[model samples]
Target chain A: MKKSIAIDMDGVIADVDQHFLNLYHSEYGVLFTKDDIAGKTEETLFPEAGAARKFAFTPGFFLTAPVMEGAVEAVKKLMETYEVYIVSAAMEFPLSLTEKHEWLRLNFPFISWRNIVFCGDKSIINTDYMIDDHLKNLDNFKGKTLMFHSFHNVNYNHHQRVNNWDEVIKLLVEEA
Target chain B: MKKSIAIDMDGVIADVDQHFLNLYHSEYGVLFTKDDIAGKTEETLFPEAGAARKFAFTPGFFLTAPVMEGAVEAVKKLMETYEVYIVSAAMEFPLSLTEKHEWLRLNFPFISWRNIVFCGDKSIINTDYMIDDHLKNLDNFKGKTLMFHSFHNVNYNHHQRVNNWDEVIKLLVEEA
Candidate 1:
């Protein structure tokens, strides 16, 4: 059987942090860099809890968000060797569902609809490898976990880290 | 809070049984109608279990399958009054995930992505009403269960039956 890879979307593939920073700048008239909010929660990044929550409910937020650097190419390359699934916890953000679907369709057209999983929980996912940015998702992953570097996860160092797509390709290749 | 309604795909929304019957005819050079397989298992529908399962794995099967009559209008109407969610046990038919998403996009574009759930289990679903073709899905539902008429579920009469979308709309409107 082909080895399967489950990849998170928001931080791992989609550049949600940049989108949030943009939102903060546009809404609050304040410029905050990714480094400024590194290893911090949304409450720390935004002025209030609701301000951060507002972004999730924003229409077209997931669709317009830029893709993470090197994600498209790296995922395509990975697909050649493994069964790749785009696993996203989209249930929390109801508005982002169709936008995320359109985003994946536009950016990673190589991935089939069969491999796209939209759910609230990650523990149900069973794959040989999981590449995600959130510690919460990787914590319960039964497979080898690869922590995709993101500003919010800067403090977490317990798992194997991949800062960029190049590093991801290298680590997976080495494992093979 | 608005009452939430969970709708099933496959036999309930998209007409999978008709699609399978068409495929069986095209593949086996034998004509089989939906009436012939009412209340029967896959083994009874096809020559073997694998033969029945093959249709699900076929590319474009979910995409090409016709939507159930009145599903689009009823679901759209339902959305106006309820927090509608399109729930499907998609994990079992991994190939149908993306195709089902696209099918909904084409047919039920009004339903937001956040309300769409693709999972292996239905027990996790929490809703005020469930419209499904399977007794198993409606059995454990915490809310009112509307059994959509399907050939296989013909014998299942425990729940309130809606033979068509008009009935579904009427029942929901009456509740409102």
Candidate 2:
């Protein structure tokens, strides 16, 4: 109960590929769609532009999206015990933090927003548990790391992989 | 089925107030716990610190946070018909979109990093549906908007709210 939980946005929250697909669609008449890219690499979605290859650290692409199912409730439940923070790497985008904060307020105003941190190295921060969608961060994260399940990310096999916050809370509670 | 889904972090991902409570306990010697604020408001969490005031938006707070319940599967299921994207907004925090992409890759690599969007205005984007916790963006979204439920934001009674994305997809699929 003394541990804290850190979560990631993007794939975990609303939809993940719609933005780029939306953009790609508007630019080119690409018909690959999400399904064509599922179980494949980013290049599958953007074949000619190599856009997926360059997206390793793109900006103005991952803020103020949607919340995953039970994301609000799970955070609510965990907040009951552990300290929660949103250490994100969303700066790679071109928007400012103020713009990002507005999205959170409009979407999840319930969060204190004070305890949030958008750092480059999330592992550098101090916390008890880490729930993210990236293997690099999760692999390096100290304490309990919960790997959020996504379609494109198929290599993660180490930590506990879950699809929702309820499972995340269950794992943390069980550990507690 | 080529469409994608997107979600928000913060209240939609995990219980934000509880995280604050954990930090509050460690910082100001405050003993306010989850039950104390469950279904309550900022007024109860921080009575002396302008409890009546609504929670402010923070940047890094939501960067690395937990995913909500059923959010993963809902996104996964929705991916069956749409390319899921994570579109979020940042305030002043220093988050890296690269790290966010890596995080998503490590967890749900199945989702292309290109799918994530750290943007400012969501209405400008196009999608079949959006599952957000806020109400303002949904005010005039061109696509179908599914409002996520939040205890802190119970005053919203004007929009079409859904308990989860499953219901949202259900409605969309039925209409289609």
Docking class of 2: incorrect
Alpha-carbon interface RMSD of model 2? 13.0
lDDT of 1 by residue, B1-176 (tens): 78888789988889888888888899888888877888787656787677877778888888899988888888888888887888887766655666777788899887766677785556545678889998878897777899998877788789999888889988898665
Q: Evaluated against the true chain A, what TM-score does chain A of model 1 have?
A: 0.94
Each prediction's TM-score against the native? Answer: 0.58, 0.45
- In model 1, the clashing pairs are A94-B114, A113-B98
Docking model 1 quality class: incorrect
Residue A155, candidate 2: C-alpha displacement in angstroms:
2.5
Cα lDDT, all candidates: 0.81, 0.59
Writing each residue's lDDT as its tens digit, candidate 1 over A92-144 gives: 66556667777887998877776777876666466789999988889988789
- Top candidate when judged by DockQ against the true structure: 1
- Summing lDDT over every window of 10 consecutive residues in candidate 2 chain A, give the lowest-scoring window: A117-126
